[model samples]
Target chain A: MIITRRTFVKAAAASGAALVLPGTAPGAPPAPVMRAVPSSGEMLPAVGLGTWITFNVGDDPVLRDECAEVIAAFFAAGGRMIDSSPMYGSSQPAIGYGLEKLGRPEALFSAEKVWTSSAADGPAQIEQSRRFWGVPRFDLVQVHNLVAWETHLETLFAMKADGRIRYVGITTSEGRRHDLFEQIMRAHPLDFVQFTYNVVDREAEERLLPLAAERGMAVIVNRPFRQGALTRQLQGETLPAWAAEIGAGTWAQFILKFILSHPSVTVAIPATTRVDHVRENVTAATGPLPDASMRDRMAAYVRDL
Target chain B: MSEWWTYRLEDFLLFSPRVYWRLFELNNAASWPLHLLTLAAGLAIVLLALRRPPGHGLWVAFILAALFAFVGWSFLWSRYAAINWAIAYVAPAFGLQALLLAIGGAARGSLAFDRRDIAGRLGLLIAVVGLVVYPLMPLLFGRPWSSAEVFGIAPDPTAIVALGVLLAASGGLVPLLFAIPLLWLLLSGLTLHAMGDSQAWLPLLAAAITVAALALRRIAR
Candidate 1:
């Protein structure tokens, strides 16, 4: 029986079954939700691993090994994209350590950034980041926080033209400079755009989200848990009764599902140091997402808290 | 683009409290047995300060200079820089403090201790805190004992001890010596505060006490 994504989503929604896509071995766990990149139609898992502060383990072999374990578990749970930046201190090296430890998984989707303030240094920083991840080329290279965006975007676009990187994009976080972020998105033909958006921080819903959808740019949501502050705040609070309808067993999933449920979001990168949390974050993409009404209710419930 | 004022202290902190403390633990592990000598050195400085021999002040300054140099190289540059890119820039300030201590010790032979003064007594107490109480902070905070930041090894306690010793001393250059250590205390205090650690106020409190002692000495004079 030929199984299409639409039919599978319909079957899962109707029967309330696990989201195990076709071609999986019998009895295997459900696969994570995958969304297509708007430019190339390349399907990427909706839940990616973020290495902002969590993976900046420095040169500590023990902590580096622990990060490798998180990566191992992240891949084991069907996660693909792993995002990091040079601005994140030793995070890139720690990711290199993890990739080397994991023997460089084939399913890896490496997303890196060129973060230097000097425009001339953009290509060199990209090369250094590529070496750090041990990947030949990044799937996406963003101009981090929109620093030196004009020159770096030109360099990134050139790299994309040369097939050095699969995608070119820009990012901003903490809701800083939304006007500038939107201006760049409007001006440039970006393949991806990353910014902060969570259940409570819904400011992106105003313009950026819609702009991304209108321009066919893939959206990678950062700070899905406000760097774990959101989950910590909601900890010990009972999960809403209707959360189960969307298969959100934990608040991590509830928040991630809310981000992923947004039609424009291509991925939500929630960082964690624990193997269990990585597994939990990946499983968030496996379950049925909240519909528009349920999404509103989830937001309202968290906002009320 | 000049909207730098919008950023908060928490925004600059890239690592969590867990990672920050782990750096001390790892530094302690990497520099074992040396901690014993550093601790002994700290005690020796305190004993020498108490004795106040004709030239003991120079000895105290020399010891503090060595400790500052060691922490600058070992902890700030070697270990903490791995996690915090900003520390690489701050490490040179530690070297500058060390140089000032050495130069001041050689040039004026000032920094003589007078336990009779209120500032001197408070300075000795602060030094003792840096040596004993600062290390015990891990235990109080429910962290592993291995992560205890030691004097002469960890930057925070080393700066505290240096500030304390500088406070106890009498010298024209003593105030100059206070600059780097006090700046470091402020930076680390801000860092800890950003991490939401309950003990965040310790360094800041230590700095404030040093400033108060300096004021008290000024008033007494």
Candidate 2:
């Protein structure tokens, strides 16, 4: 009953998930959804790739090759954003290796973070991130977990002004400092903000998501699967028949669709190392999105399980 | 505020299950043929213990020292240091264990090994398990040979071997040499369990056996 155009728009933004267009003939592959960046108005795929625990393959060529295939699969499925941080050991270089192997994917929307506290070290770290990612400039450079946010924000603002990075944002994955985060969000001129927000961990729904929408800041949702715990819990469970209406054939799509249905969310970065999982995650972008009532039903269904 | 305090052991791990398991596979790939050398050293120690060879304890001590140093430099420092920054600090602990083992062996001239006793028999069993049997654990857990953890090349079996060697020797210095390996077993066991690893209980089981064997030895004395 709470159907709205926002659902279709958010689902439409997920360009990589749908294999066929919404109005395509019965057998045609659906078009992936796309969302716009709030500040630059640049459209990005709703389903981005995260490289947190998944891409930290320190100096292992065999694993690096595996990650390369995952990247290839991601791009082939319409992924554009690849988020990483210096804190995830060797993840940046691993991404660099994968990109090199994949011939430097043109669609790569590189996002990294400045993690350390020392303001002087921020630029050098960003430079290292560039080298590790093998990029001339970054699309986004965020203050990781808001560590020394004031100091890093100034540096990030300068970098943005200098054309070193296209966007400046702050992130918090710890899920505790919402009060401080909201305060910063209210004050800072951030282009984006990332935090943990999944179907189960909906704490962001009350403040962060609403604030992001109100402030016109793009929201990148992390831990979309609660770090794989939700999948593990839902293992072997059957998808509801109603889910087919939204094109969610698998639980991956079900959960991802729930997140994508949110009006405030720009993208949900689910980190996966397996190529098949990448394909599954990308497919979540396609199909009909759940409306507000359906999202509530989805939440209730998951809770019952 | 109390969330940080409520965090479980698995909370701090920076890797997924697949990535964590892949580490072993990659580590095994990087440290090939060294498995043969470790196997040989483990056998030599078993033979030395069984035959009551002169300076058996010294030989076992040096072998353990080499294994500790190998694990320190190769596994912890070179490989694991990349993922777990804690390895950088922990690598020196292995180095310290190696040094202590070397000094203890040299100062004592030789360890007294008498298989005639219960302690000696139990010690030999523990050592042989580390050398010969431990590598087979991966097979039980449905892991491939590529991820098989072996002594000298892998920390789990290496620590178990060192603990067995320490328990077999008769000296006040044995306890000093036992400290690091004991701590490692507990740490590795808990970590593995937290990660939901199939062989999670092996290190802790080995540690428990080692303590019980040591206690039995004391009772017999």
Candidate 3:
């Protein structure tokens, strides 16, 4: 039986489903969903914060403090991982300011990337990023977009071996160069692999996701909202009543839930500027995730819309 | 992987529109009353261009040189470079523009305006827009006055005013002056476009008009 939108809404209403907004529940919030790294079994909160365009606020004191509030709100909402890159302009320094402002939460998972084309510059750049973040060491360091990957990956691997870093991985975004990404995954023993994987852009489901699963590599999904394009498209559309079943109150959560529902996805790093959005994104990890059929339905609903 | 073609313009943009505009607000706040002087200087250039006074070219170039130096240090190096790494590389080009204006226009006295020509008239109009109209863009777009990019202090208006003045002037170095401002306009336009800004076309349109005016001037000559 095909479930149309009307039938789904009617059924959900009849069932008296309660729409639970993130961090707005009457009682205590549910424990955030944590997924284990396939390589080391180290658990990470499923919904992480991405510091891309959102945190590159430069030296504007007001915007920097706003970013700090976002960090405070994220940690308060049970988020652990915060991903950034040197290519993301002032984001590293902004993160440093935020972390310093927040007194440095112990549960923070610092994930950064090495993006220089020169192999020799990798270590220096990583050290600079460390200084920018004011962190002793990063939890994960990835080769950004596979630039100078061979040398950077070797350097990261050495860092991991020397315990300078916890995990070594690689990242690609906007679904570019997946062929080379697959080759690297096949060859190297990477701890993580990050790329774009959202409800709208599911190209990863065919090969990369399976490859990560097969190779026991944790997957970090980027651009889960296509860098806000998806949400803008879905804005003002009535949330499907069945979204309550998966505990998604806002569209941000609904989209994040779809990405997290995938078994291979270890984390989805959604970048946001607003403190409320950071809270909303973190809550996506706490709720009941959609099963295989529901995941399909969610994707279909988005596609049809 | 040498797959540079795979990258989109959005990939290179690392800041949001809010942050981008805030840079101007912060710059304006830091250089508060300095904007009045810069705008006054810009207006002076427009008036000078319109009147075609003797030796006004030297004064115009000197003022533009001063403005370029100020914007290069204040806006590009001090503020924008904090968020955009590429601006650091481009700031030196602005310095080069300042030096060129000083040597070619102020020192050599090569720049001279001919209001009798169509190019000069068009150039004067562009100068007026850069001086009088560009700052009003914020009001037109519903942004606060604090975020308005003004001449001499901000890179966009400064570049636009320089382009307009260069088009009006006739000199061996006039063509050379076109390169940096045009390039800056392209870069700024692309950056604003990537941010999904409604005013992205402003710089692009200015560049197109400048190029067309130059072409028409050449054809008429």
TM-score of each: 0.93, 0.87, 0.93
Best-to-worst ranking by TM-score: 1, 3, 2
RMSD of each: 4.8, 4.3, 5.6
Clashing pairs in 1: none
Q: Which has the higher TM-score value, candidate number 1 or candidate number 3?
A: 1
Better by DockQ, candidate 3 or 1: 3
Q: Which candidate has the highest DockQ of all?
A: 3
User: Comparing chain B with the reference, what is the TM-score for each candidate?
Assistant: 0.96, 0.91, 0.96
Q: Write the per-residue lDDT of candidate 2 for residues B146-172, one digit (tens) a residue.
A: 788888888888998777766667775
Q: Comparing candidate 2 with candidate 3, which one achieves the higher DockQ?
A: 3
lDDT string, candidate 2, A51-71, tens digits: 887898777777889889999
RMSD of candidate 1 to the truth, in angstroms, is 4.8
Assign candidate 1 its CAPRI class: medium
What TM-score would candidate 1 get against the native?
0.93
**Whole-model Cα lDDT of every candidate shown, in order:** 0.87, 0.82, 0.88
Ranking, lDDT, top scorer first:
3, 1, 2
Off by over 4 Å in 3: A1-27, B52-54, B106-109
Model 2: runs farther than 4 Å from truth? Answer: A1-29, A117-120, B26-30, B49-54, B108-121, B170-172, B211-221
What TM-scores does chain A show, candidate by candidate in order?
0.92, 0.91, 0.91
Best-performing candidate as measured by lDDT: 3
